[model samples]
Target chain A: METPCLVMDADLMEANLHTLQAAVNRAGKALRPHAKSHRCSRIAHRQVQVGAVGICVAKLREAEVLALSGITDILLTGPVADSTRLQRVPALLERAPHLMLVLDSHETARILHQSLAAHNRSLDILIDLDVGLHRTGIPPCDAVSFARALAAFPTLRLRGIQAYAGQVQHIRAFEERRTASLTCMKEAGQTFESLRRQYPACTIFTGGGTGTFDIDIEIPALTDLQAGSYALMDADYRTVQSRGCLTPTHTFTPPLRLLTTVIGTHHPSHVTVDAGLKTMYRDGASPVPAEPEWSHLSYEWFGDEYGRLLTPPGTRRPRCGDRISLYVSHCDPTVNLFDAFNMIRAGSPAETWPIDLRGCSQ
Target chain B: METPCLVMDADLMEANLHTLQAAVNRAGKALRPHAKSHRCSRIAHRQVQVGAVGICVAKLREAEVLALSGITDILLTGPVADSTRLQRVPALLERAPHLMLVLDSHETARILHQSLAAHNRSLDILIDLDVGLHRTGIPPCDAVSFARALAAFPTLRLRGIQAYAGQVQHIRAFEERRTASLTCMKEAGQTFESLRRQYPACTIFTGGGTGTFDIDIEIPALTDLQAGSYALMDADYRTVQSRGCLTPTHTFTPPLRLLTTVIGTHHPSHVTVDAGLKTMYRDGASPVPAEPEWSHLSYEWFGDEYGRLLTPPGTRRPRCGDRISLYVSHCDPTVNLFDAFNMIRAGSPAETWPIDLRGCSQ
Candidate 1:
């Protein structure tokens, strides 16, 4: 395998999948693993085989890729606001008929309705409610009003609501993360209950993430969970101890590993590796070396094409040709940087899975 | 144009090209623009047309794309350390006869030489010297020793040395940046002088970037300047006042504009856009709205697929369907995210240039 590539331990990933799926199943709620984390359609298939109801994607392009891969049940979690992107909706619907979309603004819904109505089609859409994240979606107070507005569009079907509290996914403290996520979901659930009273087809209350999955599954309103990073964990999630309070402690181990080669070891304090901000993204916490022997060293961004590991006292410094496996800081953006992941099964090469939906931000 | 896509003003970019090329020409040094900033082959061809002798790339994959596009004199600026990547040298050489690679370690050089020896071919290599970056490259004191070691290999030819002062590129103050860059280059020049006497083939002393190109050209030993970002300036470069000290204050105008659509206007304090960390990379400075009328708002990363512009007091808020043009925070990583550049010429669509070398980090 080449340096600066993603390597996934398939056995560990399979174990992670079963653990998360079993937990969600035990709670009697559906699991729609977010495909935006791992853009590969193969993984989405595996998720479906492991009892995932459907998959969620962040963009229309991601939906197009997954839909082409024959996964019909896909919910696009983000809004398609512009006309250019709205043009792609009909073609994707032709492939995956069960596709659902989220709508935060009436302006976007109106444009999408116009586009879909031209093709003599109707799309199932969920009212995206702002659960304190405020990034997208309508305010929770205006859910009924937004749904009433959507009633005017004949080409759009009213589904349930999607209220993902993305802001609480990385909270370090367990009680705080629980309280924050529950408070937001509780308010969103109240709005969903009111919307459910009005719309008969509005049954799917999909939301929650890996961080508060245990707490969120207890919510009677949340019919399905859209947790992504649980399938292939990263270093960023390990900081949240609350996520590990399940039956088996720390059930989700990081299956996704970043394999990088050391290029220069001349510097006494640090060794430069082939992976940098370009190979692995720089949004989240710094990546940690996967091996226990090199735990003393810390990763730092050198440039676009190089990263350096600071060698603490008594740390074993890596040589030029030596390879270092690292747990990626963040999974989603880092996955977007690579073309494919080298799948390893039982410490051997299994297959290479293409990141099919990479650069699907459109 | 689509939302969250890169748009380059061709005329402004052409002016930036002419201004920098003229400066380097007057200094009697070759201008080898780095292709990593703008991975499009069309832009590389444009840079060559504007008097660039060759182009520099950070990865072997980037070189492959540019070489396939008929760019012959390409320099792979970063080291290709492992055997898997070294095996590609012969094939690249077949396309680009003058393709040069950087070498920082004897382990990588031996592996590369062995690979080339198998193909019965020789390669041009530049010894990378550490200029206080401590990322890649050998120490300046070990340049001659490294050169002597290279003489032991038959498949590798000693072309020159490369010393890039990446640390001083973003220094806000002009005098501080100038002093730091000159100090590093002077030390590197002394090393080059010693190595030049030992190896007569060592003529091309290529280094420097858009940040230190002006200061580095003053060093008589620096035969070529490998500046990249001047062609399409970003919000990060605008902070470096020294880069603007050339003829006609602020000679390089930011031709690259990130076009995004307002997705949600439900929040009272801010409006959300369709560009986030995934659309525009979150390294370096925050992107500013291109229009002067909305200058009061500042950008904040909302999530992976959305960004928020906080509407301050007396600020005119954008509607749901309004378009926003922003100066990207960073150019290289942001360019890698997009597949094409929506070229704008004379307030009209000129062409769509594919970012052919995107996701070529390997």
Candidate 2:
């Protein structure tokens, strides 16, 4: 369990967490998952023990590492706009009492209601709108005045409407990621129907990802999908294209990878390896070799701790110390360049996990 | 010190660590300074207190986080081939007895002489050759039979060459980065004159970086340099071009940047911010706005934690929460995507540091 590390495959990630929680509970929605893709509080408590009704996290340091690992329904999804992380969102709502927070602006809902109204606490939020990913939301023509200025922040509680469209999550075309996930579910179902008729505490709309999780579970105004990289499939989401009813292909099974070794060969066709771009996360591509006998190789970036590969001429290469594996190309910044996650199973390793919100990216 | 952190100007990083340690001690070389580019053990003990004769790590978990921060002369520079990192290199050479490692295989010098002959210790090594960045190294006709099979590894001591032309460190033309750093200092000066005529305890030939630290201090068989991003200049080494006698354009002074904020504006021009590609390191390109009043803006990546910017239409946008400052495009895998660093100085945030071998990237 070493070579450049990060393994996982524990029975193919518990069969990709029981096939994306039985296809987001057969599309009636509510899976949550996305703990910023395996920042591992034991894979967000095994995605809330396979049902996953809560865990999104984009950062309040991944909702304080999945709320100090107890994992009470998290949500975050970006937008905290720093008052040193909105004063740690009322101490991450005292370790995740269903903490929500997505905000888009009445100056970050008055700096998160003056840091949760000086901790008398009342947080929940959501409002982030702009479905097209202008990178941070608020603009379904100003989601009803930013959910009526985050319902005048008496410790902020609007509780719904995020609209994620992270640039159509790698749209390599399956009807253009289902027409851009139905145009971000028709503008987040018109800003969750005008903030559930002027805010009856807007009932949780959330967002979608893992390449529009089967067109955001057929979008009936997304009650909650937030999809984090379908239990670690990568190589840029295994080249997208999973069409309509979701099984035209890739029902997801990459189960992370990486391993590595082969620390240098280079003569009649390069080799190197020991991972790179600092243990693989070069944004959109390059990290393949899960051995199809080195499928004519390819890789490249050889600096932040080497990578190379190339190997064209006769094809098979790979010698120095050999090992290999690979896959990655972006599984949440390659699981935030690892601090743990070995796992494996019917082939070795077993348990390691620890990414505990890796570098948390504060 | 929050809005997307990673600051570090502290008097332009103590004047870029005393101008690259007085230009590698007026070209007679020996500076070392890499610590995998600011994996900060308090910036490698402030680059070994301004002169830097130690530190250049690439992994054994960044030489066990710079030998548990006392940093007793590191070196590492990749190629360990993991038997769980060659059994932690004789317990990191008992906390770095001037560590040094870099091999180029005899199966990694018999897995570091059977893990330092089962800890009876004795390490120092090197060999690693092939300078033109054929990643990892070896080929100078197999460096004298790989330093004569690492001198029959009686606990291994060779210690001479290491080559490292990391693809000629971002060559944006200064006589094509001095003819590719003088063709990697003429094949590492003919393999350091044939391994100093067969290892006369091969006195440290090392390599160079921070774009061939002024063409490897005019290469006379480089006795050390190893320049890690000249104390943090970025935006792709500020597009290189520093000519022969150096300093015609950028003689290092970027001193890291990132700050962030303006969390989404998008109106007449766009803005976003909250850093991106998981806080800047999009392998060689994106990050920019270190304000010339937003110098026609630009940036882009907008996803793994935002970024966008673009503001051209009559410029000057950055509205939302304001704060600005970007710069980055590569400062060692964006200082391994942050866990600390702040530092600043006259503009604020006086001292945070902590990137202590960030995710050590084993």
Which of the numbered candidates is closest to the native, going by highest TM-score?
A: 1
User: Chain B TM-score of all predictions, in order?
Assistant: 0.96, 0.39
lDDT of 1 at B334: 89
Estimate, for each residue in B268-309, the C-alpha lDDT of model 1 and write its tens digit: 899989889887888888998888987888999888888999
lDDT of 2 at B180: 73
- How far out, in Å, is residue B83 in model 2? 19
Where is model 2 chain A poorest over a 10-residue stretch in terms of lDDT? A241-250
What is candidate 2's lDDT per residue for A241-351, written digit by digit as tens?
Answer: 787544324788787888887766756778777788877788676788776777678887766777778888866787777788888888887788778888878978776
Error of 1 at B217 (Å): 1.1
Candidate 2's residue-wise lDDT over B1-362, tens digit each? 66677888888878888887887889777788877878888878888888788888877777887788788888887767656668877877887888878887787678778878887988777877876667766777678877876778888888788887777778777788778778767867777888898678888888877876777778887788787777888887787767654443468778788888877775566877777777777877667777787777888786777777787776457677778888888888878878788787887777687887787776
Q: List the residue pairs that clash in candidate 2.
A: none
lDDT of 1 at A312: 79
Please, what is the whole-model Cα lDDT of each candidate in the order they appear? Answer: 0.88, 0.77
